[model samples]
Target: KEGRKLEQTARLIQKTAEAKNMPATKRAALNMQKLGRRMAQGRMDKKQAMVRMAQLTKQMQAQQRQLAQQAGQAALGGGKSLSQAGQQLAAALQSQAAGGQNAQGASKMQGAHSAGSKSTGEKSGANGGNKPAGQNAGHGFNVPGRNKPGDKPPQNALHGAAQPTPEMKQIAQALQQNNAQTLSEQLRQLARKAETGQMTPQQQQQAAQDLQKLADALQGTGMPETQQHAQAAAQAMAHGDKQTAAAEMRKAADAAEREAQQQQDAQGMQDAQNSLQDSQGEMAGAQDPGDIPDGPSGQGQGQKPGGKGQGQTGPPEYGGEGNGGRGGGRGKPNTTYHKGQKPSHKIRQKPGYGADAPHWLDPHFDPAKNPRYAKLYFGKPRTAGPSQAGPTRKTRPGEDTGPVRSTVPYYNSVVSARKTAENAMDREDIPPAYKKNVADYFNSLQPQSPPPPASSGAGGTKP
Candidate 1:
């Protein structure tokens, strides 16, 4: 029983190495390698090895299903094929297996295995031989054109595989049927799934790309509503607002349905035209009358029937018979004041005629044109008084006045001299004499009157 179990494990490993499902085959190959190590190291007995092998078999089976599903998804998503993925996985597994043994021996074995596998794959492709063990090459399912069990994956096939989603399947079906309404509905559901964060980012991106393709197809078929929904879905995915995109898709579906119904009903078409005409008439009527220009005779074109100046009687022109004078229908003159009433005689000069007029007020006044007045008017104006009046006498600091009089000039002069002396003293280079002069000047500026004597008492005056 132990020998039989060992043989079975070897067979399973060989079959896994040849499997067409790349992910599953790789997983199985890895487990087989680990099992071989355990057996060689004497770590697992017969019963234990059998149990582990059974576990591995079950795991491989599940993985196979997963890998198949992934391949289908890849085809639907417009990516790599199942056979290409499997070939890549086989190569990786062989490399791993080779690394486990003695270097020289492993290299020899790996070369043999690669050559044999290549020949076998070629034979199957050219002669239509029986499908290899543990491979799904000859299955009846529809696959991408380039996909075949023995075919190698593209150089850029290193990216992880994407699993199929319900939304993706529905979209594929809708596309196959070429039904715009159905496609719109499926896209809406996909957008909703993306909005709820149920789908992975990669899946969302793929869905968005597919939607764009569908939109293009629909656009070519004269289904703008459906195309719009798909475009909106793509945009929503880009902005991460899947819910809004879904809503837009739903609206597109509804619009398509409505359009179909409208095509089938002739009365609906007539009603729509009538409604459009009514709306246009209302818009024209709502326009402001003042916006329209009056004709030469002061009558506006396109005016309503009952508007002013239509048929109502009014005063005739100057030559009509109603009035005696040339003026039509004589009435009180339209004047604020009587003919003899004159305004005030206060003559006012024009704006630019004043002496204080700004230079810019005279358009012809350019400094370059007339340089004579440039210094007088364009440059700073002359001071109001003479530039240099009589020389101001400089009095000596701290000089005493003859008397103290309660007059403005006397007080002003004294205050001014004191301030001048104080300012001179503040200068760093001034001598101490200047400070002394300021102090003396301040004392002289004080009033000369003595203080009044205090009263003897409140009730007994001089007594």
Candidate 2:
């Protein structure tokens, strides 16, 4: 009986130790391994591990309590085996938790409890040097390049470069946006070269430059983000200076500026963007119905860049008839003209110019097949004044008819191009001077038309 009692006591003590031991479940072991590795990497120290372990222990205690309650209920009902096991497990955990064991302690125990076996933490913290410059003793607190030392994070962004601030993100965004458009073409070119199995050094250099510019811009914006980036760059350069030495230097300098507190990230002295946006709104609200737009800015609309006139091509009905005035027409000033008349295919050739009159007329104007002006003249062939009122042909021969008649279709074509171009350019908030040039170019293309047809034998003979 005495021997049995001693055995029982030993068993009880062993069980208690087991409970306190906090079984290294696969998850627990993994966590321990991770902590050990981090410590060895010089990324963390004993204190950091302790903090983490403490956090984990709290979670385990909560789970243990719930299990105990379930087991207690079972035991009360006479279903004792499973309940017994739960009770034992609960008691074990309670003892450890009561002893104030923390996650950090548990993690350290994993290292101390095992030996002769290699471990991540031991391997990493191998130098046995405490507090290496760049590495945190525990919990990944190291700045970049401790053996090399990274710059401290921007003070404004965090207490001491610990967390990213909103300003930092904005700076990053600006950095990316500034370079995005310009390098789009270059990116495409590189992609093409890769597909074709070759890349040029120049292309590679340009690509690196583009990326450097963006990274620097973000860092220099006085954002906490700069610290993270700065660290990364330092690490990259630590290896016998870096591969992209020149490029990295540029990026670092750029970031240095961003990290400066005096450089306001937003609302800088040179910011002209807001004024530009207001200008755009004014332009949107101020679009004219009569102008036919043209330019790289005007797509689908048949106008030229700089608001220069392009002769109408194809059928006139493809586009609505030329705007007669500001409110009614698409490309020109809306006026009393075409008010009563329904929109039609009439091409207003040159206006107010008699048939066959001057050399200054549009050189591209074709009488037989110019679709834009054909309708205006065709609609009212006899509209020209009578011969007594005026000669059909102003010149005897070889002289031009000033310009072609103002045909509804052709006039409307001009209006379409002008309007579309104007809308696009205006939206972009281009300078007023540039916009004016666009407007003036269109106005110059208005075709001169003939007077009412002559009544008797005029110089012109009609088929």
Candidate 3:
């Protein structure tokens, strides 16, 4: 039976070999080698546990060492350098393109970040959906005479390739439908329009760029006219540059600088106001003069030199206190005895001389003029009325009058005088003997004249 089994196995193996290619058996041998390798690595519970424990211990030690180093660095108080990410963020904010502000500030933070503005690149990243300034060239986006994909004419393209733009298809269709006459008429219209200067400045720029793109697109699209038009447009656009862009930028910068300068001036004015407020406060706290501190100096203001306080009282002024002028209360003038107190004896009536002015009013009217009449007037009083002659007097005619004043003495009173004279002599007015001698002598002198001479003078007058 064994022999029969072996023969069957050999027969089955031969049949399998005949049905397949020889390479399939080589692959079978490779598969048998792979199965032997898989069976050789058997699972072991105890040995695997020991290896896992060792690995766990080693990993724990390494982690502990790393933690210890970190702790030591923290305790040493070392300042840390900024991370690469933070540094890059700061650098981006400080870039030249970001003239006004830096990167982080583009988001508009408060406090420290608010002080510096954000960069242009950062702003572009922030608001690129809008027309950001960073990517703008002087003119239109596409350069002149440049090829544009998906913008070529369909007729000029390879078969089964992308279709052409609407403008390109329109132009191509027009060209296909035109003869020389129609094309010439269209060309003439275009020439007239160009000569009339129909385009605005912006439209001209866009048109030039579009023509260049069309020329490049038509080069392989079987259109020679488009190529010429593109070349002309590109050259004209190149020469049309006037540096207007740079002048606009400079003008903007100058305006910004002026605004900043005005801000600084406003800040300076505010500071000056603050300083003035401080000075006012100082003055407000100051004490008045004469309210001096300890030794007669005003508080804070100090003492003036020579026993005076700064801003102190002035000198005792005239016409003040006890020194009032005329009509002053309780202050009197010196007593002076004036001359007009006495009366005068002499009087003259004249116009406007009411009582006469005063004794002191006139220069000559002095009470002390004469020492004796110091209290009296110098002249007599005036008569009350006109003068009258006394009663008329009669004289005896031719009565032996020699000189009217004195030829002989009057005798009628002589006897009466003799008696009185004798009596006055008897009273010793003259001594008695001297009086008798005077009488005897006068009686003797009366008898001594020449009587013949008197007779002779009378006889001559009679003859």
Candidate 4:
């Protein structure tokens, strides 16, 4: 369990690394408050203020674009699993004639499809056969990777990375608009004019109006009240009301700081930091013992210098008699040969005879001693349960009403099977009547649409 926790923590670290660099964005948000304060105090020159404004806008726009791109990729990845589901369903339906194999294949496919759907919804991607990355965010806690029945799961470093929040796409769309981009350009132009001492009164008024528009764009970012004060400050500037503008800007700056603190509190950022610190302290004081023997081949307290002196430390072909010796016993096959030397004779064994052989070349083996040898089963030994003292009692009245139990067929399978049958109907080898019957069967299995509401004059029920 400790090892598992370490693995999960490592995956969580990788996931956090893959997440958008929110710290940079958050710092930029906080810096806006500082910028507002400098403006309110008249501490910075107009040219310097404008340059800083332009830089901050560009930084925010870049971050928004990156978030938008990530969200888009995750959304596109979701549809991919549905396509894979269709393929699995089609293959299962087509293999119905294969008896038990078909049943087993269908059952496994259905399980994987359901698991994948759940993983997609929860953004955990714990299912093994799931495609790599972008379909989900964080890994499920202690959930083992689930591959197909007989297949190995594909490895991915970023598999733990979850989908971006919906707010990311919304915020990006608002901040990356033409007006936001134009506002940045306008700031740069205003800065250049102020630097050259060519800034006109009308131009200053226009810059204030542009700033208000930028603040309006920011209103979509869940800080409407805070940004509203920024808009008021901009309006005051446009009317040549420096005192009111300064006061409003100062208020806006304070509001932004409060908002940031509230956000950190609500998200439990401080708690997470504290927990991480505690974990680090514990890890720092821990140490591993070096004296324990690792395995049979390890050095400490062993039978010999090379341990048990298995074939691992012996000649490939001719080894001393002991457990795991290449001469006999349970060692690996003798594959090493001199450059020009070959065995004088070849040894052959019947099919499955090698299953009990220590080395494939040795066919004279005892199956009774081989743990992996195929065994015949008579039947399962039955054990009797406790006998009741009296006659069987009828189930209680409420027992039957506990819950409805039924096997609900998946809609994707129905759709896929119908599609496959339709394709088969187009083939010339199949009879038209048979094709029609198959089509009718699949069509009946689909969910039916509800009937439309009756019109006022068409026998509609009175409210």
Assess each prediction's global lDDT (C-alpha) against the native: 0.40, 0.34, 0.30, 0.38
lDDT by residue (1-463, candidate 2, tens digit) is: 2222222333443343344342322233334345445544657533564565455455444543443343232212222232232233234334433443354355455535443344644554455334544334333233222232344522221112222222222333433443322222332333344335352332233333333333433332223333344444434433323344334434444543432211221211112222223323443465333232212111111222223232222121122222111111133311112124333222222222111111232433333445443332222122222121111222222334454443244443666777786785667433332355456556655534534576667676642
Report how far off residue 186 is in candidate 1 (Å): 1.5
- Cα-based RMSD of the predictions, in order? 38.2, 34.8, 58.0, 45.0
- In lDDT terms, which candidate is top? 1
Instruction: State candidate 4's TM-score.
Output: 0.20
- Supply the TM-score for candidate 1: 0.23
TM-score (all chains, Cα) for each model = 0.23, 0.17, 0.16, 0.20
Candidates sorted on TM-score, descending:
1, 4, 2, 3
Candidate 4 C-alpha lDDT tens digits along 386-415: 211110111222243233322333343567
Candidates ranked by lDDT, best first? 1, 4, 2, 3
lDDT for each residue of candidate 3 in 235-261, tens digit (9 for 90 to 100): 464355323322222232333233223
Q: lDDT per residue, candidate 1, 303-352, as tens digits?
A: 12222211111111101110011111111111122234332111111111
On TM-score, the leading prediction is 1
- Which scores higher on lDDT, 2 or 4? 4
Candidate with more favorable, higher TM-score: 2 or 4: 4
